[model samples]
Target: MAGTVRKKMSRFNSMISLDEVSRIVKAYSWKKLSTVEVETATSVGMIAANTVVATKDFPPNPRSLVDGYAIRSAETEGSSPADPSRFKIVGKSEAGKGFYSAVSGGESVEIYTGGILPEGLDAVVMAENATVSGDTITVSSSVKAWENVASRGEDLSAGTVLVSSGNIIKPWHLPALTDGGIDRLTVFSPMRVAVLNTGDELFPDAPDHIENSGMSSMMALLPWRFSNTLWIGQVHDDPDDIARAVKESSDRWDLAIITGGSSLGRKDEVPEAMGIAGAIEVFGGMRTKPGRTTSLYSLDGKPVLSLSGFPSTSILMADLIVEILLEAITGVSGYRIRERLPISSDITTGSGYTRLIPGTLVEMNGRTMVAPASSNRGMRLGSLLNSSGIIIVPEWVEGYHSGDLVEFRLW
Candidate 1:
């Protein structure tokens, strides 16, 4: 049964580039995803299913930016310390309150910061620039129209797009959305994921129980509240047991992540189990170092990401690949924070494989730069701990010299 399964999935046995993986992922026919309406305040990390536009203008009315006297700009023209302008004080305006009467020629209204601009008032003169007495104020400086006041609809206009479709909601976006009168947002529904850890040595109750760091790290890196996952715990290296688990998970979860048994080792049974469970091959291998054995398969329309059993490799693959899979399934492209910085030292990579090197950002010579965290690319879990981001070297490039600018993706 294992041999037959291998033959069926062997067409993609050769290594493929990440570009090919992207093409295949984009071309896959996925089922229509449902959208949910969530409160704008709590929608951070959710993918926007539709564009959110402002319902009304922000700063609904013109308001005072500083505590000053609201007056006609023409009244203060040519006014200075030597030749001042005087006006009679009509009334005071506070925030959320406006003067009921309009300020005519030779009249001023005392207005505080954030107070609604009085009717017929087009400018404001700072209190320090005006001398106040009983019902009279003298202005020593000239004022311009609409100066020191927030104009209506200046911050955000009605019908302006607050959040575009296929964008992930962020915390900073909430304030603008609320100001734009958006109480709720339409976002893609959260996905259910099942994580399965394989290998006989992974038994937890036994004395030989190995810590499943791969499973723990994968779960931790996924965006909280977005990828709702159920840990299937550990399954032994038996093909039948693995196949049963895969089938059951595929039935219940939107996606499945199986760690271990992806390579051609003697104990590797995940490939055979996937075949038995009627999984179709999407890509067998990738041209990426440390995660070259990372393979993707599909059962029905759901995807399964088969990662290496090695803790470091699995964790890195999860950080990079899971996001792509989620975006593909939800039909929403999420944003990744990345920067291009010059390397502090030289580093070498083999040809024909894209390399992901963990690194830290350092300030040297008054400029921010990236320095390689570990020379060892395999089984270096400590590298991940000390690193702030990943340094990517594409397949076409052989290596990088010191001071060469490269793209870095923040974890």
Candidate 2:
């Protein structure tokens, strides 16, 4: 009955599976990185270049790892609490100072934290474990050679791959890169993308109109949002208007995104408009719920991702589709929001359509469960204000009882 109803509607193009669409994007993906020398301080959240070799060997010299008595391992080999090992402290080694004297048979050096290790002294006893007299320190514990000693080049080599390419520089990775003398790096330029909100009823700021225009607000968060998301604004249902916007924007954008008109099930004008333009490739019309109306095409050899106008469908589809395409192009996989949870309540869903529900994941009885929030599709824009992610359930499942594990991604 459902298939019959779907067939009755005009199927302009055959629906393709998610993997098939992914393959098409993979084939069309291209990486043209922009070269810009960014300060190490400013490039904290960007991808790394090929690799950055260490400018100099880390540590550069043997250093003390603790504040204790630095002594030759042989001198402390037979030391014990009953027969404490006594060594004459000839000199003190503070941080940045090199101990020039060599520790002989019963000699030791007083080394502070980070101080240069004295010659011939391979181990150090912690200050708490050793007793210091007027001119000698007694360590009762035995230690092997090189204990608590940081050898030169132990942390980083002179020429090593600090951070490789395709890595999104995180806060933690920055310190290592900067401290390793990688103050400059080559990062892939941001993807050039433009937003084309289709349909005549869609308004950029109108409360009701904007809400109806699918996942429009997510743009402000895109990596290229502030600089490259040419909000090219809205295009009417007219074929000419949509075609012109696609052509004009295609020049400035490596990829153009049109929200709302790709769905031919409704009175959608996007597919028709793209046909009238120079050239395009449509790989949507999938047998999926919420996002089935989504499609992607390449206008004039430039890629464009088309999405349904519904906010729920748009948001969910954007997370999946954009990451898939961009990863192939730039190797950036964005963020993943994970809060392990089960179905809050039993769900009775029919077979043959992939399902994605905007859910409120909560902890109940020491287990997280997802509860469906709304099914309005495009009607509930405010519904996402508190939402985290969509629980994607495959189309083949009969239903899921409360307490089934499902993972979600952040918007």
Across 75-150, the per-residue lDDT of candidate 1 in tens digits comes to 8889999999998999999887788886678999999998888889988888887899999999887899999989
Q: Flag regions of model 1 displaced more than 4 Å.
A: 1-13, 204-209, 331-334, 377-379
Best-matching candidate per lDDT: 1
TM-score of each: 0.92, 0.84
Task: Give candidate 2's error at residue 195 in angstroms.
Answer: 1.3
What's each prediction's clash count? 0, 0
Residues 305-374, model 2: lDDT tens digits:
7777766567667767877776666655444555657778877667777666677767788866677766
- Point out where model 2 deviates above 4 Å: 1-13, 29-31, 49-57, 90-105, 158-161, 203-216, 224-227, 337-341, 367-372, 375-379
Best by TM-score: 1
Model 2: how far residue 20 lies from native, Å: 2.7
Give candidate 1's whole-model lDDT. 0.83
